[model samples]
Target: MHIEKNTFSLIEIPKIIDEKGRGNLSVIEKDGVPFDIKRVYYLYDVPSDAYRGGHAHKEQLELLIALSGSFEVVLDNGFEKKKVMLNKPNIGLLIPTGVWRELENFSSGSVCLVLASDVFNENDYIRNYSDFKLFVGA
Candidate 1:
């Protein structure tokens, strides 16, 4: 997996609508998401002023989706920075490894669902900005 450090993309999942409202499903084995699903988690009931994800992963890849409400994701590759707004249930943001990410501006009652490529490993995280910059040779 030779992923570019600045390579982040939005993937659209198919939504089904019928007489009984609407719903969507995301399958990791399908092209809807790029990695093999290993871990799944979600964040909800966040304060309007609260923020999450202030670090970069060394090898873990993730897909972040706004299941409800809205939020902003700020990504930095140690050289370039980008901001993306996630406000749809059927849309996801692919976060590759070696990129710094921050999630903020979350609406009240927002739910952030994350699909991870690897299991939990504390050693794979770069929790400090200074350390991340040095690691990426910024």
Candidate 2:
């Protein structure tokens, strides 16, 4: 089956707030995500005008969270495209395989935290949009 841009979902992470005016905390355990997390990484100190991620995965599922500030994620699933803004730490966007993704509009001090369903595998990536479109037969 083919995945579409509408298939993506935004997940709200559970949070614990301190009543003493301290701070807030969020957790992502086994059930927090649909797939088991096999890898974790983060992007930080990105210029607001810079763009990151211009590829689609063949067999990877990812959850992107704004751990600090804010950024926008542009997603294309061969047939359609959508833009999602991530500004809160307690929210995450679930990206399924076969969908192209791009990151942009980063605010100052923005940090992007990513949780993956698989480890690094260059072969699983489609680096070109045309190739991605061909692969998806769109």
Per-candidate Cα lDDT values, in order, are 0.88, 0.92
lDDT of 2 at 125: 94
Clashes of each: 0, 0
TM per candidate comes to 0.90, 0.95
Candidate with best TM-score: 2
Query: What is the per-residue lDDT of model 2 for residues 9-30, given as tens digits with 9 covering 90 to 100?
Result: 8999999999998999999989
True lDDT of residue 69, candidate 2: 93
The numbered model that scores best in lDDT is 2
Candidate 1, run of 10 with poorest lDDT? 21-30
Residue-by-residue lDDT tens digits, candidate 1, 12-95: 887766556555454444566677888999999888888899999999999999999999999999998999999998889999
C-alpha lDDT (0 to 100) for residue 115 of candidate 2: 100
Off by over 4 Å in 2: 1-6
User: Candidate 2, clashing residue pairs?
Assistant: none
